[model samples]
Target: MTELDSTAFELLGSTGPFAELVSGFNVREPQLRMAAAVEQAIDAREQLVVEAGTGTGKTYAYLVPVLHSGKRAILSTGTRHLQDQLFHSDLPRVCEALGVQPKLALLKGRSNYLCLHRLQLTLEEGRFARRRQAAEVQAINDWSGRTRTGDVSELSDVPEDAPVWPRVTSTADNCLGSDCPSYRDCFVLKARRRAQEAEVVVVNHHLLSADMALKEEGFGELLPGAEVVVIDEAHQLPETAAQFFGLSLGSRQLQQLARDAKAEHLREAGDMQNLPDSADALDKAAADLRLAFGQGNRRLPWKDIRHKPEVESALADLRSVLEQLRTWLETAAPRGKGLEGCWHRAEQLAHKLARVCAEADGEYVQWLETYTRSFAIHLTPLNVAGIFQQQLARLPATWVFTSATLAVGQDFHHFTGQLGLHEPHTLQLESPFDFQSNSLLYVPPALPEPNSPSYTGAVMDHAEHLIEASGGRAFLLFTSHRALQAAADRLQESEYPVLVQGQMPKRELLRRFRELGNAVLLGTSSFWEGVDVRGEALSLVLIDKLPFAAPGDPVVQARIDRLREAGGNPFMEFQVPGAVITLKQGVGRLIRDAADRGVLVLCDPRLLNKPYGRVFRRSLPPMPLTRELREVEAFFAAGMTDKGEQARA
Candidate 1:
């Protein structure tokens, strides 16, 4: 292996651009270990797993090596927000510091950039909502005038979830290359070309998985040529990988395609009016799916429903129609330059639908997931371990997975095993923060069981007290959206300002919460991790329950049954570890800096009633523990008083 430069390390430790960039940040032993691991992974061409705690500067640690290494690499994150941050802010700062002018390109899943041809067609066709069309046209007009990279994220007004954007954007499944007249100015193709020539590329895990899954569909593959692939937010890998390997069809996607076809005049092909009938067919397919499932509310195993022949037949028919449609679209694509782009998009969508339909097997669980205004038919694999192993083994490039919550109770077994990672080098680096003085863990006593009728109310009572103590700076984390909404409603009239998740976009809500300073935020799932609220603004984190996957969930149930046949206790083998890692993530949200201090209030009485609670607590930072609500309040009040005195002095 190539040796790390000792003098360079010492110089970085002493003075230089590295010192300037990281001067405000504290580098501990774990961060150094992370830096070393990154270097070794690049040098030796081997897999490495380093789970660094929160506030560990994992981004810089990995970027340092990329700057120093002479080889090419691709860094894939889990979120578009992070992808934008790295490409726009993080990478530039690091590159400047190291004085390394490496060509870098940011490639998101193709859906993020504007497809000029599609946008122009949609606008001219008068297909979209008037206001939406006007706004998108204006944004794209401005985007086209200034965008060198063509990423639509440059428009601040456009939410990532906007329907108008997708209509104007291109996915791998829908992009036309050289055959399209707009190929010379295709944004996605332009970005991919830039990536092909660059030494370093930044991508999200979703796009990375898509590249891996659809290698033949794109330019070889996204990261296949790179020497090293570093995955940040690594705890999310298993779930993200499962999504790529599985299948899903949303009602919105089907409906949109039908609408777009009619608007774009593509439905004018042979026996034209027959196209709208296809929409009717899709509606019937949807109705049949819903009826077969019958008021689908709970997540259940596939075996439980496989006995119903009607349900199975409906699924088979849906898949068959999708396959036929795709085949028809592929063959009908016109050769005319102007019309060829539209033809290619139709074919690509067909192919993607067909690919997903093929993967929706009986081994995978299917469920109807309802949102407030939308719904989707989701198919998730019973166990992604085997699937990930199959995929990863094909690639020769080195992989490094790093996250603060990769290990449970200091054991990497649960995480690694879930990813089918065996005998890969594993290291659990301890937290750099001085937790003894920096934080406290408070498990409120006399709480109702999670299964009890009064569980939500009881948890909120404790949360109310914590918010009062912290002067309303707290994140009330729940295991379900129902529970989170309930708490938000209850706290709406409280003295402290309350910010709920669904009230606005996540980024907007977070912005409002930060601006409010002493506000109470209630959220589920997404907020449990990947949130960085430091110091006094966020002092208390209240967890409503242990975040175990719902036992009734089809995917969870199937995995549990799979393990049972293999002579394993499902609760201990699967449930406990998963919940432990999740709970740790929720707790780790507090104390992001050396001066930061806070209390973690776990409202789940099961931590006391159940035998597995110790595992969860042990995985968290070593902080003073108390079950008394009074003691928790006192600690927060003390921190507040000290802060006030410091400000006055």
Candidate 2:
């Protein structure tokens, strides 16, 4: 091996810095292999995709290589939370262990940093939806006086989801750029400067995609000199890329514009009631459009409802008022920076609304999603391969995309194809944990087809048995909210503590579950991935069915139609591969640590009955598979016995 390769192996070896400095460290062959692959890719300036399974320590694998290379690198994670953790927690430890002080910076989107201009506007207005919001604003004002970073995350007094955040934080659409009165003290610009100067930069996928979008989010700054780009949790990029590449106009944006217009009107031209009047008119039109959407949250093709009289009328009225608002803002644009920003936002939103409201061009799926009080129209591209590939071509960085769940059945075709990656080197590393001994995959016998009317009841029956076997430390994952709610209601009277999703925010639910120790969490999509609960706190995962993308969803349907037009099997080529990846995520929730033992109960009959199920079966970790409830019972019984013996000893 080369000296550099030997150096990497020795660093993460059994007697390496991590093993000596970091407590509870275990060197794994998979981690070492993955790290070597990353190092080679970085040296060769190659595109590499690695599925370093859970427990493979993929984070340190790539970090050691990047730190060793001493090259400018951009490390992108899945979410802002992960980005923070890597910067504040993981990166520091690794750097300390390696005895290398790399210049690092953490950069998030503009909304994360408090905008002094918006805060000044909000303080002057003193308008709030509730009394609590006023208090939150006051708290923010107090904290703003001393925060060096001006990141809203620094203020713990106000909840992250507080309504006041939107009022204070700037978005790309509303930011006044260099014209703002607070431009000199802009936290976003300061953060970007740090990132631009740093040798190592940590960011989330949203910002990465936004950067790729280039002009859309005002990002394309820090990536110019990046010699290596490591995308941790790379599975999320395709969907995030789709969002960034798409055209969207939301109710929140329009309402925020209306509110900002009113705020700017009072500041700029109080005598001209026309601007405020148009803003109010636009609010009314937006409300009417939302009301016309009629009830439960749904996403459907815009063409499906475009012809309905109420929808058609409400949409036309909304468009008219939005255009009128843009015109009024044009007259008011010379007044102030805020008014000018509002004018630009209005013009952009109006143009986007008109384009998305128009007929599809066969390349995009024109869809509308309605919420309880708001709605959004999106024109998402059927494929993002060309756009993604073009962006990568512009960058001279070596790319590494690693995730616990990227490949399906030992191939990167499903993932690499989505991004038009050309001849990328790929690696599939099985989890280093001894899953064959520590975990069991149990598929209950005689379950009906997932579409059967009695399927949910049957699944709940199986859930009851599994939750009992694992003694309440289980996650009852369902494919739909309907099934989730049904399971929650049924478990209401059970002896075990039942924590349901949407009962509270996701973070709170997880915190409570970890605290409760034996609580059963019934959740849907969000809970399927990125959750880590080791030890006995989480010992069972019961999936109601294989998670398939909703065939009825506008984007899915559009893609299906497109594939059919091209004479491809959408089910095998698209749906099944996607489902396999998702199922891997859910299954991955169990057996997080080597010492941990758990049961994975996939309550779907399709695994055994369908021909394509082999793909999912092959893709999962090599756990002992079973079909009998007795075996599951015995697994837990053995765990209890071992604990008893350990305590006694």
Candidate 3:
């Protein structure tokens, strides 16, 4: 400890190893402070939460300390992209800079790995709906022979969402584990083994939450031995925890179970025609249940349609088919490990279906979601705090949660209360970049309320003016797909290239947006966060309205009702704070680096018309605010002048 403490000052100093090796690295006071705080928390084995604002170099801030400490730690990030960045990029750089060789491993969800058993089954079937899918499966088969890790991401030629993936990947229900021929070659198991032995393991929030919520019982020992857990993007943990802690019975799960059962029955129990018949019945029943929801997609409280004749009949049919399958599967359980696995999965699914379809439990909010071709019934717990706290108790380790937007106006209550963090240390580090000078917040005047029918038109009118000023390097983010579509429709004849979300894959869309350099992207909620376009690729950001969770959403409505029933103000306490964090994420896209400069145009008039707007005002970065059109144009003009001056220098 003494040796490391003496070297800490020189390690991240202006001319230190990090500055020498890493590109564009700067000595930040906040980064150093955060590192010290993380070190202290790791040493004392305490829980800590930090709201490290953007540009704090938070990745290196915690990485340096954890690498120096050499503890058995788990680093969970927000998404797969971040997981890859941390493990494949940041971790290696930090390890090299510190001259350490601590063993490291990256683990993703089971679905991300190629299942050799499933691949063989798919090959034996030798059938694909489309010629392209047939080619994709052959490509995967060729790659599977040589790939070491068996991670599907290794084959870049094939798209991630290709239908061939589901055919080749093993789900918990379908995996034969040690009883299968490919058990020794199972990529999921091998990854887990590597994670179990590594000093540091990198994972995503969804996978980490699955383990914490006990969703994957007895699956692996990934989290049990960790001395410290660093959760980046902690702001997303509560929602992810809620999802994992809940129970869900979806059409896809049922359909997969049916498909696998039929396939296995053909090979293992060919003499038993009853097994295949039952599998087909179950599959048809699941699709019928989806059909009961009709064509339009929506989410509603289960009670809303529980008594509908069509839906009720479909539900009954599904349960009957599921029970019949279980009965037949019981008879054929001794056929093989595959049959035995199907029987177990049917039992579990039946139990989940019974629980989900039954009367609502007060602890969980029962809801049903109908997609275009599928439906899912969920029992999301009203609160994940207790469930989360229990898991944290079981794993008594130093826990740290950090994100750029965890706090609302310097208050962490909204985040802390969600996960039941007890007396945990909290730190808020403002971004080191000069936001006040580098960015301007523009709220065009005379706009109608967001709920008004003419709102999209009014917002786009100002969006165009701002886009012209900034030369169309812009992201016009909306709260709803309808609004984004409406805006996209209006900009068809515009001079600048317009890229709309859903026109292509998100990664490819972002790639083209960057390459075009002056393109306008119109996107909905997913675009608000996790999409980073730094430098001149993106300079102006226009958010259509305050990103309030849809009040009509079943889960959101249930939470609001629950809170209100308990004599709490759900609007101010929950919705506003959540929206503030979301808006902060949108605002964050403008200025990613110290040299980055841009304009943020917030079109929501509620920001100024309503009194609650003050909370949002204080929560945003300390940027220059404006409601005048001339000022926005002037800000961009001055930005152009700065660029010209830099170019001359």
Could you tell me how far off, in angstroms, the CA of residue 600 lies in candidate 2 after the best superposition? 0.5
lDDT of 3 by residue, 493-610 (tens): 9899999999999999999999999999988877878888889889999999999999999899889998999999999988999999999998888888888888888889899889
List per-prediction Cα lDDT, in the order shown.
0.74, 0.91, 0.88
Local accuracy of candidate 2 as per-residue lDDT tens digits, 220-301? 7678788999999999999999998888888898999999999999999898798899999999999899899889899999
Model 2 pairs in collision: none
lDDT tens readout by residue for model 1, 37-65: 77777777788888888767788778887
The candidate with the higher TM-score, 1 or 3, is 3
Clashes of 3: 0
lDDT of 2 at 478: 89
